[model samples]
Target: MIDVGLLLTMIVAVGVPSLVARWWPLTTFGEPVGFLDVAIWPAMVGLGVGRLVAVALDGPSSLGSLSDLLIIRSGVEFWPGVAAAMLAAAWSAHRSGVASFDRLADLVPLALIGYAGYEATCLVRDGCYGPETSLGIRPPGTSTTMLPVGILAAIAVVVGAVVLHRQLGRRASWAVVMGGLTVVAGVRSLAAIWLPHIGDGLTRQHWSSIAVLLATVPALTAGVLGGHPATRERQLLDR
Candidate 1:
């Protein structure tokens, strides 16, 4: 079977910028970047980082031999890819003379939706799953199942993307949109605790989600206090 998770990531990696290039409102930063920088660069960097982190998580065994690093099949983790993409966007923006945060803000919508799409693949693959429940839906031939964690995550990301996309152009604000993204991470983490298949202790995803949530708290607070860009612009216009 085709690796649905990897397939979705590739789709999002390519599809988002293709759409942005044509219809996206031109931003001071994004306006300068060609599709290769925005889409291709991030995807390539993300894939490398995703593999690196997965190997790191594999402990001494993965680090024992250089050959272990070449096992690309085992390095297909999701959150690492997202982290790499974020960093890659910032680096690319810096190299291209665009504001890092501005470029990040522009990409947030697609990133969130991409994340959600990635989560949806769990439905088709034996990927990360939640704790088994009496109410859970099982795949064919399986006697046990868990809560639809992936489906829930997908819903959260899609909704968050829609909320942020409304602020495209001059109305975009990192505080508002990224705050929403952080909330999704925190929520998915909270939900994951009840999942039966997460194995023992806090997994990498849990730690990353918590880290993201903690990091985003200040931004969310500041955004709520300072108000969204749209509101500020409207206030200025009123004056």
Candidate 2:
């Protein structure tokens, strides 16, 4: 069973993003805007809040639990923070006259980088452990394989974005990057679903997978509509 505090944290993480989308009228990457646009800040804040909560609940040992591997999944706690971040980001983009979706597309790489960084920090601070196996490779003092994977993913996202940006132009490249992210995220979810019991700790990959799929619907939608002159014309009139 998941710890009550951890459960609460997960719930908040999932809920925040949905609430932001419902509350704010914005779109991300040509998709109907939801919590992702505003997710950055709230996620950051949540990290802090989560840490404090952990300290209060378990003292310094909480840091060791950071490396405990879990599937990236969404829950009530995570989404709300994501939604808040998305809301803020969308509003800022709208006010600046940048296409909210387009802006978000460009920022996706950076966002991933930040997220990975956070995960790495958590691994160090919490000292979580992964499964023990003959094939397992542990970093200096940690017990999980997540650190390397996290770093690799982060590098891939950032490098891909940079290369795509240079070759395809910002808007097109961002769309491609985000589209790829959506696909990778989806595949990861599927793997989690199939394996179900592979990761060491409580896996949230299930929630993350669902959220990514949901988010992709809007992203693809926006990409399609954005290219239509009629949509642009309608948007101009609405503005």
Candidate 2 lDDT over 59-127, as tens digits, reads: 455445554212123212333444455556557678868876566655454454444344333234333
Q: Which residue pairs in candidate 1 collide?
A: 130-195, 130-196, 131-195, 131-196
TM-score of 2: 0.45
| TM-score to true structure, per model | 0.75, 0.45
Best by TM-score: 1
Off by over 4 Å in 1: 1-5, 12-37, 64-67, 70-81, 131-136, 169-172, 198-200, 229-239
Note the Cα lDDT for every prediction shown: 0.68, 0.48
Candidate 2 lDDT at 129 equals 32
Model 2: residue 177 alpha-carbon error in angstroms: 7.5
lDDT, residue 158, model 1:
75
lDDT of 1 by residue, 48-70 (tens): 77777787777556766778775
